[model samples]
Target: MKSNNSLTPSYFQFTVFADYGPLRYLFFSLCLLIYMIIISANVVIILTVCLENSLHQPMYIFICCLSLNSLYGSAGFFPRFLMDLLSDTHFISRPFCFIQMCIIQLYLGHELTLLTVMAYDRLVAICQPLHYHSKMTFRTMLLLLMFVVFYPVCILIYFFYLASSLPLCGNKLHRIFCTCWTVIELSCVDTTVIRIASQFCIVISIFVPLSFVLYTYLRILLVCRRSSSDFRGKALQTCLPHIVTFGNFCISLCCEFSMSQYDADEVNSSAIITLSLEFLIIPPIINPLVYGLNLPQIRKVIFRFLRINQT
Candidate 1:
């Protein structure tokens, strides 16, 4: 017989899956319905933003990008997740796990950077209305989009470099899906360096954007206070949805980070699963609804599209 130490795991088993028995089907059906809604809702916003000439403005374009990112994040997790809900075996291959991690990390990073840029856009629009058009020009938006999408990619490369060579001591993951940190926890050797590196990544990837977002809103708030009531109401009308979306995403992110880093080893698996999935489920569904329904321009265009489809 081969030595256990010499054998590396080719697949990781998910240990967090609860035995729901007959209720699994009900859970699967509900999740499938949510996935469908996420797709359809985000797609409608994307199509409306692209097709309507009036929506080519920076605000609408950023909203479209949020929907696009939501679609990307949802596609990464929901299909595999839906399958797992109905599956008897919850195992994922090593390579596919890495791919899923990349998709999720990219989605998270892209989201924050995109939100940061949107905050900047609103800052200029509300605080410096005369300079908004000139400041957020076509080239500027293109460069910002490039930064938002690519920054996460660069971080993923470094993360994989640090993690790829670590010898695995086990193959059972205590979560529903793959994550870099979870996999790193399975390493046979001490991972102090890797953990620190990850913290650094979090500060750069999460904290910086979060700080910038807060700063922008502070400036916006100050401007609102100094202006008339009419101006304050108009400013709130423009910034409210973005603020809600940003805050919602931050809370979800906090749940994911807190559960992953602090509670992963010892927490009740059943309890963490709900909050873990909340980050993946809530934001994608909520983002488009908040933006599409609350914003009159996108909502008007979406209604027009629906009317055309019906007729």
Candidate 2:
């Protein structure tokens, strides 16, 4: 067996131990509860959409995709996290660390792009209802879904490749989980090239979709203004959930980026972990609730299913 000293250099130690102290078990239990809720809630939404053929429209399909993405994102972080909380040595292997970083990045990219897709779907449904069916055909939606999944993975892969190629002077990552920027910071050599590449990836992965989402919503607002009260109400009922989800996601993302880039040193370890975790925790739970409660059809189906199961 390898000596502990020999193995120490091969892994990255988590800094959360300093923050949690005696409360680690309590924290772990809380996270476990939240994760279970996240998984169950998203799964329910996924099944509801799948089983209810009435939810076969583009809007509901996109909601399913969003919930699926939530589960994907949460899975990437929570399992490893819960394990770390239980362990005495909060260390992760180098390869595993890189893998975690990639998953988190991919999750963020996929989420922003997916939200943008949902925005476009809403815009077409409200502003161009006449052409909505023709425009958002099965083929069109398939392509959009493909893009939603593909683009993020591609961007993250490139960035991960670049980050992995760098020589690390040290192995200690300050955050609870491995993030790409944190990994990049641990590199010994100049990371100017990697930094530029990362910035480019961030723009392509986040800002482009954000711009499209904003423009789509602007057009949606214009269309709703000119239409009758019934149209406006219907649009609000459908679009509000997406808007709230998007806004919450964006705010959490902004906090994550801000903390990682600027406030890592200034913020307490516990605060940083909480902020970093918000994107993973809040969005997964809220997305399904927002959609299930706000979308009448989904709410009705969910209630009907619960009633049947209760009997």
Candidate lDDT values, in order: 0.86, 0.85
Please report, as a residue range, the 10-residue window in candidate 2 with the lowest summed lDDT.
Answer: 1-10
Error of 1 at 24 (Å): 1.0
lDDT of 1: 0.86
**Candidate 1 deviant stretches above 4 angstroms:** 1-7, 263-265
Question: Candidate 2: misplaced stretches above 4 Å?
Answer: 1-9, 19-22
**CA RMSD, predictions in order:** 1.9, 3.2
Candidate 2 displacement at residue 98 in angstroms: 1.8
lDDT of 2 at 226: 93
C-alpha RMSD of candidate 1: 1.9
Per-residue C-alpha lDDT of model 2 across residues 1-311, encoded as one tens digit per residue: 54444433577878755545779889899999999999999999999999999999888999999999888878889999998887888889888988888788788888888889899888888888899999999999999999999987877776677567756666777788888777777666687777776767675666777788899989988988899999899999999998999999889878886776563567787788788788889999999999999999999999999999999
Which structure among the candidates has the greatest lDDT? Answer: 1
Query: Model 2 residue 221 lDDT?
Result: 88
Q: All candidates' TM-scores? A: 0.95, 0.93
